[model samples]
Target chain A: MGCEEFELLLNGYIDGELKDPDLKRVEKHLAGCPPCQKLVRDYQRLKEVTAEMKFKNPPQEIWDSYWQRVFHRITRGVGWVFFLVGAVAVAGFAVYEFATDPAVEALQKLIVFAIFVGLGLLLISVIWERVKASKTDKYKEIER
Target chain B: MSLTEKEIVSKCQRGETEYYEQLVNKYKRSAYFYALGMVGSVEDALDLSQEAFIRAYRSIKRFKPQYQFKNWFFRILTNLCISHLRKKRRRRVEVSTEDKEGRTMPLPDDHFNPHLLLERKEIMRQLWKALSELGNKHREIILLRDFQGLSYKQIYEILEIPVGTVMSRLHQARSRLRVKMADFM
Candidate 1:
């Protein structure tokens, strides 16, 4: 194989992933080729430098409170779900009571009902826009 | 005797939530450091890593027993870091110089030579700066292999890519990194 072909396998060679014929071929090429050898040296140096670089360890308090923080987040998520459900239930019952009350005027009920319909439509519009944006966003694949 | 990871995961699957603490404790440093490497900020790394654990716990039932837990957790953590990077890209806000300077790795106490310590710190800082400038794929491949010390097969498992792709990607990433660190080298 020529240099270009061996170039592709050079990484595997350095990483010890090459075997048999491929390994022998790279070794033969490396013996004859200074550029390939230089490439190998460069990559090895990069690896060594990266190996020496480490992030500073976080404070002990972060570790001590780690599990507790996660647990609180989980419980808080559940709490928010319950709270939303209760809120919607209470609002629905109140709306039902107000609409059915004989003492309430027809115009007052109509105005209140219109306000809710407008709010619901606004919510749906916002959700639809977000879904559309998410689908077409150019940065979507960055997360992949 | 300490329970194996599989046994702990089994207990967690069986509704014993307390067993999960063991998994979290075991992998927290790995998770946090990986996040720190990707995001280049201490606070964001801590928050993102903890968020990944919360996400893993929420979906624990979907975890297949045949898979290694570290690889699975890393996949989740990596996705979070990538997504965080995506959002940061959208904002177009540069990481402040002070934040970067504040994150130097701790030098060993035995290295009492002041000049050597300063030189090492400078090299580390330059290395990190180069790393942060890389594209997401390049940066992540380097981190998974060089810094995290994951084997090619383990990297393939975590990345859900073929082994050939892993090697090629690592080579490309290192090449780009070499260009970035040309002055230091």
Candidate 2:
């Protein structure tokens, strides 16, 4: 194998992931290549040091409440969904009643209708802005 | 009695929400450590890992039984961390007000002092500093293989890449780390 090809197999060899025939081929190349031999030693040492470095364990209290926190999040999520839907439905009904009521003055009805329209337009604008921001957001597509 | 991951998932799918506690208890440490390694912050790691579990619970029906629960759950987690990192970089760029040829430049995270979490050994601190300096992809492969002790095949499953890709990426990642730790060597 040429140097490039040997270099490709070096990782596998160091990782013990190479099959016997490929391992033999790599060993044969390393025998005549001092640079590749040095590279292997360096890689092996790097791996050893990395393996020895472990993350510190978190406190037990975090573990104790971990599941409870997740449970609360799930419940809170469901609650928010219900709350938003109910709020929207109630607002829509109130607006419809106010707009259709014949007992109210003409100016009063016009002002109420205008207020609802303004609120509706504001909501749409905010939603549109959010959608546009998400489109341009660099983090939108992460590697799966 | 201990249940297999698949069995636990199936029970959760059957509307037994309580069964999920078993799954959470089983993999919470692994999930938290994986996130900590990826994001370099303990608080964010705990939040992200738990969020991943909640997401998994919501989407368990989409998970085919052939897939291992751990791999399926980890995919959700990695995607979340990657997204979080991008947002964090964007926030830093905004705060620094440094633009290089119309592209935003992320500021170094000088505030993220991992020494509080890690032991005071110089080598350990150097290892973490070197690991944090690595790009997300390189750091992820190293964390999975070295820190998490996952096999290449398991990485292939989680990352949805070929086994050859895992080996090559791991090689590149470790080579970069070797360069970073040249002072110690």
Candidate 3:
């Protein structure tokens, strides 16, 4: 194998991921190649140095309250969903009643109807864009 | 007997929400550190990691019992972190200063002499800086392999990439890191 080819496997060799024929081939190349030997040594040192590094620990209180925080968020999320659904339903019924009432002025009803129509169109446009974006998102497949 | 991770997940799926505490406690550190590595801020990391767990809990029903919880949970965390970074990029926010200030070096060992401790601390600081300077993809692979000590297979599972890709990416990442650390080495 050429040096370049061996270089690709160097990491595998260092990481002990190489197997059988590939491992033997790398071993043979490293036996006679001083530069490759130096590369391996340097990579090993890099790994060793990195292995010593650790993130400073956060306080114990973060751990103590982590679950409580998550639970609170989850419950709050559910509560918000219910609240929004109920609010929207009630508002929609109220608007419907006002728009249909005989005593309401025609111009006022038209204006309110137009406002809801505009809002609906805007919501549909946003949802459509989000769907299209999700479909076209290059990172979606890798991330999810 | 203590319940296994799979059992805990199964219970969670069945509506025993309290059982999820085990999972949160088990992975909180890893989740936080991984987010810290990605976003480079303590506050963001804490928020993102906690958000990941909440997201996981809400979607526990979709998680299959056969899959490793760690892999699935990390997939969520990774998405959140990457999205956070992208948004930060769009905003053109400068976070490097905060990153440096927020990170602390490992405490010096009492066993080591003062001079050696100082040298070690300097080396660690340089390494951390070089790591943070790496491109997003490179830094991610390094964080997964070196920082988290995840196996290549586990990384493939979490990243949803081929094992071959994982190996090549890790190699490329380490190579870049090596170049960045050349001055000190």
Best by TM-score: 2
TM-score of 1: 0.78
Q: Each candidate's DockQ score against the native complex?
A: 0.29, 0.40, 0.27
Off by over 4 Å in 1: A93-144, B93-120, B183-185
The lDDT leader among the candidates is: 2
- Residue by residue across A85-126, what tens digits does model 3's lDDT show? 999999989988997899989999999889989999999999
Going through the candidates in order, the fraction of native interface contacts each one reproduces equals: 0.49, 0.52, 0.52
Q: Candidate 1, residues A22-110: lDDT per residue as tens digits?
A: 89989999999999998888888888888887655666998999999988997798799999999999999998999999999999999
What is the Å distance of residue B110 in model 2 from its true position? 3.0
Measured against the true chain A, the candidates' chain A TM-scores are: 0.68, 0.70, 0.68
TM-score of each: 0.78, 0.83, 0.77
B95 in model 1: Cα distance from truth in Å? 13
* Per-residue alpha-carbon lDDT of candidate 1 for residues B63-182, written as tens digits (9 for 90 to 100): 999999999999999999999878765534332123466753332221112222123577676787788778889899999988898888889888899998998898789889888877
The local lDDT score (0 to 100) that residue A37 gets in candidate 2 is 94
DockQ of 2: 0.40
Choose the strongest candidate by DockQ: 2
Q: What is candidate 2's lDDT per residue for B1-185, written digit by digit as tens?
A: 88877888899999788899999988999999889888988888998999999998888888899878888888889889889888787766655545667665565685236564456578778888898889999988888887787777778888899989998888788878988888877
Candidate 3 stretches with Cα past 4 Å from truth are: A92-144, B93-120
